[model samples]
Structures are given as structure tokens and as C-alpha cells.
Target chain A: MLQIENVYKTFNPGTINEKKALRGINLTLNPGDFVTVIGGNGAGKSTLLNMITGVYSVDSGKIIIDGVDVTKMPDYKRAKYFGRVFQDPMMGTAADMQIEENLALALRRGKKPTLRPGITAKERIRFKELLSMLDLGLEDRLTSKVGLLSGGQRQAITLLMATLENPKLLMLDEHTAALDPQTAAKVLSITDKLVTSGNITTLMITHNMRDAIHYGNRLIMMNNGEIVFDVSGEEKKSLTVDGLIKKFSETSKGMLSDRTLLSD
Target chain B: MIEFIQSLPSPIAQGMIWGLMAIGVYITYKILDFADLTVDGSLGTGGAVLVVLTTQFNVNIYLALVAAFAAGCLAGFVTGILHTKFGIPAILSGILTQLALYSINLGIMSGRANTTISWRNYKLIVSSKTDELFFTILKLIVIVGAIIAVLYWFFGTEIGRSIRATGCNQNMSRANGINTDTTKIIGLVISNGIVAVSGGLLSQFSGSADVNMGRGAIVIGLAAVIIGEVVFGKLFNNFVLRLMSVVFGGIIYYIVIALVLKLGLNSNNLKLFSAAFVAVFLAIPYWKTKMAVKQPASKDKKTVSQKEVKGNAAN
Candidate 1:
């Protein structure tokens, strides 16, 4: 479970470039909750995720995860409780490291890292089994440089890496936004499988309204730094992209930009 | 040829010193993706500290060397803090550290600019005609071997992987729970420590320590790294081999310098020759990569098909 209370973040406060990225925001998620977040440009979606992940400290807020307050934690410390997949495929992995080595790192998250030989036979077997689940045949290329992987394959591997330890929370920040449509679909399916099988709590931010509707047990729409629409369970299941846009218009007239409503 | 063989000790010794500096430079420039100019000053800082500690303070020579190594690590840590904590760009942080070290190096030398270790009591150089050959080879083997071993062991550990990962991708390393800021500090500290060792050895070999001895060292080290990477890039996969290649690169670089001097060139023009050598060697890999890119894949149709098979393996 996660909680955000009265969160406020302002970038470059008091300067000419000052912008209030998050304003008096409050959110909560139960265990096993998979929440899809919909927002437009400058909607503070990424900022919200960044604050939750401790990439940026909130100006005024308290963030609690699984009963532990982590708003003041550094990125490295906060990483122990959450797995993240960035929008850029190249941003989530060391390109020069081998596939198995990358997974080894992921598997050791929140645990004491040892200086023992790179990988043991048992660890290697476990890695192969996990890689096989991606259905990308990455298990066969365990020693291959991750740099040579296609975007889709790397993101799939990254998704698997994020969930390997089944952290308290998982955050996906438009993780498939950079991939082609077909590959994105494949990765999205993998994401679904990962969340469902592990029953992990997740907060996914996306620009694609269809995907926002298609997945997750809950949906929340963010605009101007606050969550304006929160729908869940059967309410979320019956919502269509058009109906969501209508709701956005009703909640905040003329605030729903045309570009956002039509974005894939 | 006999005379050249007899004179070989000087160049070989110089090569080892340059090799150590090159490895230091490689750690920052290659491994940490940092342009660290601190080596120019810290290298001399190492020599100055050792000289002052041993000769003026009457400290033991080995203790002097350890002190010099610690001084170098301190300099590196300062640079790391400036860059990571203060958010200064790496280049500027290195420059700031380099400037600070100039005054420190001067203070260590008592503003004398240079000092000799006075071989009156110490037989540091092993210069007897009978012992020269054996001693030179012994020194080369031991110094190069020790450096290679340390680099190998350091890079094979979990901390080493985290350091390498920080170099490749700092953000991802942080996301994986590796503190990249701390890793950068440790990497640079170790890098400069080895550089100081080289300085300590140089002081012993040359029988003197000069504050100006480290001049143009950054360029020289960069030259050595680029040359080694170009020549041995395909020859090795292990990090140890890569580090050793820089030592060998130092030797090759000095040999080229010696050959140029042999062909009716003045030693005074050595800096120019060093600069030219570096420029040419640095361009070799870039040009080679360009040529490879320009060449059609059809030239190696069989290999092309094999690569396609590998691509298919991913699917």
C-alpha cells in the first residue's frame, strides 16, 4: 500500500521560471492495486512519479509505502522498495553489461551484494527460467551484450527485472512509449502478466487513453497537478475513452486540451 | 645497437611511469567518463609529498610513498565532492582541483621547484653495469604485474561492477540501488592512488623529484589510452588485459619518441612529437570505425547472414 498526503512540488521556486508542478495532491493505493494514470503534457504526471520514486523531494508532502514514510529518502534508498521502468529503453540498463549480469543485479536488489564469482550455476538457471517467461528467447543469449538487444526486447527484460524482487511498489512511466505499436502491445501484455501474477501494487502513467482504459483495476486522471477523476472496479471497467474525455470536460471545462484527448 | 641496449633502462623506466599515469587517466576518462585534469597536479603532488616527507622530514621512504598515495586520494576525493555534491561539471571540478594542487605541490617542495633524493644513503636506481639489466627487467615485471593484478581484482568484484555500471549509465545504476556519487568518489580516489604510486617510483628511478615533471601528463595519458584502445581493442575482452595494454602503450609511445629522436630530431621538440603522436593515434579508431560503417555489408555476405540469424534468435 502507498499514500501521498498534501504533496506540493514547485520547480525553481520564486524564479522567473518557477512552475508549481504538483499542488496539494493526495492519493492512496491498496495492496494488489494496479492503477493506470492518464494525463496530458505538463500534467505533472512524471513529476508525481518522480516524487514517489524519490528522484525529487516534494516541497511539502509525506509519502508512505507499506507503513514506512519515505518522502525524505534518497533515490538509492527508495529504490529498495520499488522497481521502475523509464520511458527511454536505454535509460533502464547498462548497455555494456551482459543480459545475465543485468538480471543478476536486478535479482540482488535490496539485498547485500556479494563479491563472489559473477554468477553461480543455480543463479544462472533461475535467470534462464525468468528470461524464458518473456517469450523473447533472451534465455539463449544470456551472455550477449544488452546493448545489442532490440528496443522491445530490452524493455521486456527491464519489465522482468523490475518485478524480479516483487518490491512493495512498481512504477511504469510510459515504459512502452518509445517502441513501435506492435512491440508496445507485446510489452504491455508482458506488463499485465507481471502485475497480475505477482499481485503487485503498481502506478502506471501513460498518454494513451485506450491503454489507460484497457488495463489496471483502477484509473485516475491527472491535470494541473491534481487528481481530478478517480474511477475503480466496475466503474473503471465500463468506462470508454470517449466517456473519460467527456468526464474530463465536465470536471474541468476547456482544461482538457484537444491534443491530449486524441493522443494514442 | 649496443649503445642503444645499454641506454634502454632510461626509456623503459620512463615508459613505466607514463604507463601508470595512463592507467590513472583511463580510470577517469574511460571508466568514469570524466575529463580529470587533476592528474597533472596530483602526479607532481605525489612526488613532492614523497620527497618532502622522506628527505626533509626524515621519514621512511616507504612511509613517504604511502603518504603520497593518500595525498593523491585526497585530491581525487576533493574533485569528486566538488563535482557530485556541488553539481559542478566534471571538467571544471577537475580544473579546480588541479589549481588547488599547484599551491599544495609548491608548499611541499618549500617553493624550491625541485629536489633530489640524494642517493648518498639509498641505492634506489640499481645502476651498476652488472646489475642494470637484471634490475631493469625486475622492476618492469614487478611494477607492471602488481598494477595488472590490482586492476583485475578490483574490476571483478561487485563494487567494481557497480562502478562500471555507473560509468555506463549513472541513472540506471541509481535505480538499481547503486550510489553512483559514492562510486565516482571511490573510482577517482583509487585512480589517483595508482598515479601517485607511479610518481613515487619515478622519484626513485630518476633520483630526483621535480614539480614540473607532471607537465602535459593529461595529454600523454590520453594518448596512451587512445593508442592502447585502438591497437588492442580487438585483442582483449578482460579488463586486466585492457589495463595492461595501457602500460604496453606507454612503452610503444616512448619507443616512437625515441625513434623520432634517433632520426636527427632534437629532444627539445619532444612535446610537439608527443602531441602529434596523440593526435594521430586518437584519430585512428574513429577513422577505422567510419570506414567500417561505409563499407557495404554485401562484402561479407556470409557474415551478414549469420548476423541476421543472431537477430532472429532474439525473436
Candidate 2:
């Protein structure tokens, strides 16, 4: 479970360039809840995730993971409780390291690193087994540097890495947004399978209304640094792209300048 | 011609010693993705510590080298603290540490800029004054062999792999639970430690530790790393071989310098030549990309850092 308690963040406070990024946001997720977050620009969707992940300390709030308050914890310190895939595929995996090496690092998440061989003979076999599941032929390229892989392949590997240790919460920030349409769909399918198979507590952020509608059990719409609409269960499943866009427009007073939010 | 051939042994031995410093630089520059200027100070620190310990304290020569390495590690730790704990930039932190070490090196030499240890009074590892130049060269090769072997193994370990990950992709390392700041500090410590050891050895070989002995060391170190990459990048895919290439680069650099001197180039202009040499090699890759008739596959990789920029724009 994850808890966010009335979080607020204001960037460049008291300056002429000041902008309120997050405004007293509060949310809670039960175990195995796969939540998809949709919002227009400046909705503070990524800020909310960053707060939970401790990327930036919340100005005033508490973040609890698995019943432990981690609001004051540094980003790397609380990394044990969560796995994150950034909007950039390159952000999730080291570019120059080999495929198996990256997986080995993920396999030891939350554990004190030791002087043991980074990639053991046994772990190599396990990594191959895990890689084969992606159906991307990465199992055959265990020694290949991740930089050499295609964007979609890198994103697929990053997905596997985030879920490698069955993290308490998985955060995906538009992980497939950079890929081509076909590749994005494939990665999204992989994301759906992994989240359901592991029953991971996930909070995903996306701009595409269809993906926002198609994936995850719960949907929350954010605008102006606050969650404007929250829907889940039968209500979410019954909603279509058009219906969701209609709701989004009404929440923002029908001033929809960016139509691409629903174009996909 | 005979004179030039005979003079070759001294620089060859000198090259092997400087090669150790090159490996240390490789760790910081190539592996950690940090341009550490700390070696300029730490190398002198090592030399000062070694000479003072051996000549004044009457310690064993080998033990003195260990003391020098410790001194170097302490210098590197100061730089690490400045960078990681105090929030200073990596390059500035190194410059500060290097600047401080000049006074410390003087202090270690009992307020003297140079300290000499006579080969006749105490045993030395490798000295040009002795007629055992060939054996000295052999001993240095063995030493370099052992150094690379240990480094190769260390880099393959989990903690060491994390350091490499920190260098290549800090965000990914942190997501996997690695504390990158700690890793960067560890790298600086290891790198400067080795540089100090090389300095200690060079001081023994040449008979004195000078405050300016390590001047422009980072440039030479960079020169060696670039030369190694240019000469052996394709041939050595294995980790151990890659390290050896760096040492080989050092040897080649020294030999070229010696050969040029023999061919009538002014020794005073060597520093300028070295600076120009590194600049040209650094530009070669870019030139190759521009001159290629067909663009390479490596060009297709759209740099992935743009994702962070987009993430910022979205928020």
C-alpha cells in the first residue's frame, strides 16, 4: 500500500517565476491496485510520483510505503520500496552496461551490495530465463551493451527490471511515449501482463486518453496541480475515450487547447 | 645513433613508471566519468611521503610506498567530501584538493620542495642510476601486470559494477538502489591512491621528489587514456586487455617523446607537444564521423537524455 498525505509543492516560491506544482494533493492505494494517471501539462502528475519516490522532498507532506513513513528518506534510501521506469527509456537502465549486468543489479534491489561477482554463472542462467519471457531475443544478447538495443527493447528490459524484485510500488512515467506506435503498443501489452501477473501496486502516468482508458483498474485525472476526477472499478471499465475526454473538458471548463491529449 | 639507442632505456623505464599514473587516471576519467585534477597534488604527496618516510623515519622502502598510497587516499577523500558532501562540482573539488596538497607535500618534505633519497644508502625498487635497467623494466611490467589483474577483478564485483553503473547512468543506478555519491567517492579514492603509488615509484627511480614533479599529470593521464582508446579500442574487447592497453599507451607516449628528443626536437617544447597531441587525438573521432562516406549505425541511436527534458516539459 502507498499513502500520500496532503502534499504541496511550489517551485520558485515568492519569485516572479513562481508556479504552484502540487496543491495539497492526497491519495491512497490499496495493495495490488494498478492506478493509471492522466493529466494535461502542468497537472503535477510526475511531481506526485517524484514526491512518492522521494526524488524531491515534499514541501509539506508525508509519504508512507508499506506502513512506513518515508517522507524524510533520501531518494536512493527509499529506492528499495519502489521500482521506477522514467519517461526516457535511457533513464531506467545503464547505457554502457551489458544486458545481464543491468538485470543482476535489479535482482539485488534493496539488498546491501557485496563484493560478490556482479553477474554470477547462476544469475546469468536466471537472467536468460527472464529475458526469454520478453520474446525480444535479448536472451541471446546478454553481453550486448544496452545502448546498442533499440528504444522498444530498452523499454522492455527496463520494465522487467522495475518488476524484478516485485517492488512494493511500480512507477511508470510515460515509459512508452517515446516509442513508435507499434512498439508502444507492444510495450504497453508487456506492462499490462507484468502488472497483472505480479499483482503490483502501480501508479502509471500517461497523456494518451485511450491508454488511460484501456489499462489499469483505476483512473485519476489531474489538472492545475490537483486530482480533478478519480474513477475506478466498473465506472472506469465502462468509460470510453470520448467519454473520458468529455469529462476532462468539463473539469477544465471546456478550454481544451491541446487536442493531442485525446488524439491517441 | 648508438647514443640514441643507449639513452632509450631511461625513458622506457620512465614510461613504465608513468604508466601506473595513467591507469589511475583511467579509473577517474574513463571509468567514473570525472575529470579529477587531484592527481597533480596526490602524486607529489606520494613522492613526498615516500621520501620523508624512508630517509627520515628509516622505514622500509616498500612500507613507505604503502604510506604514500594512504596519504594519496586521504587527499582523494578530501576531494570526495568537497564534491559529494559540500555540493561542489567534481572538477572544482579536485582543483581545491590539488591546490591544498602542494602545501601538504611541502610539509611532508619538512618545508622543502624537494627531498632526495640516495640509492647507495637505501634499497630502491627501480632506479636509473643502477645498471640493472633491464631487470628494473621487467619488475615494472610484472607490477603493472598485477595491478591490472586486481583492477580487472575488482571492476567485475558487485560493488565495483555499481560504480561503473553510477558513471554510465546515475538515474538508473539510484533506481536500482545504488548510492551514486558514495560510489563516486570510492572511485576518487582508488584513483588517487594509485597515482600516489606511481609518484612514489617515480621519485625513487629519479632520486628526488619535486613539488612540481606531477605538474600537468592529468593532461598526460588524459593523453594516455585517449591514446589507448585510439590504438587498442578495437583489438582489446576484454576488460583486462583494455587496462593493459592504457599501460601500453603510457609506454608508447614516453618512447615517442624520447625518440623525438633524439631526432633534435627541443625538450623544452615537450609540454606544448603533449598538449597539442591530446587535443588532436580528442578531435579524431569527430573528424572520422564527418569524413565517413556512409553514416554509421551508431549514429541512429538518438541520445536518450531527451526523455528527461520531455518529462520536465510535461510537468
DockQ top scorer: 2
Instruction: List the DockQ of the predictions in order.
Output: 0.36, 0.55
| Candidate 1 global lDDT | 0.83
Error of 2 at A207 (Å): 1.3
For model 1, the DockQ equals 0.36
lDDT (tens digit, per residue) of candidate 1 on B1-315:
677666666676677678878999999998888888889888888888887888888888778878988989998999999999999999899889888888888888988888888566664532223446467557766866887787777766777777888898888888888888888998889888777777776776666778887788888899888878888878966788888888878877877777678777898988988888888888887897888867784478678667556543432
Per-residue lDDT value at A137 in model 1: 92
Which segments of model 1 are wrong by more than 4 Å? A111-121, A258-260, B1-9, B56-60, B118-120, B125-133, B287-315
Cα lDDT tens digits, model 2, B116-212, are 9878888888888748788889889888888898888899998899999989998888888899889999999999999999999999998999999
Candidate 2 segments whose C-alpha is farther than 4 A from its true place: B1-3, B292-315
Taking every candidate in turn, the Cα RMSD to the unseen true structure, in Å, is 4.3, 3.1
TM-score of each: 0.91, 0.96
User: Chain B in candidate 2 has what TM-score?
Assistant: 0.92
lDDT of 1 at A31: 96
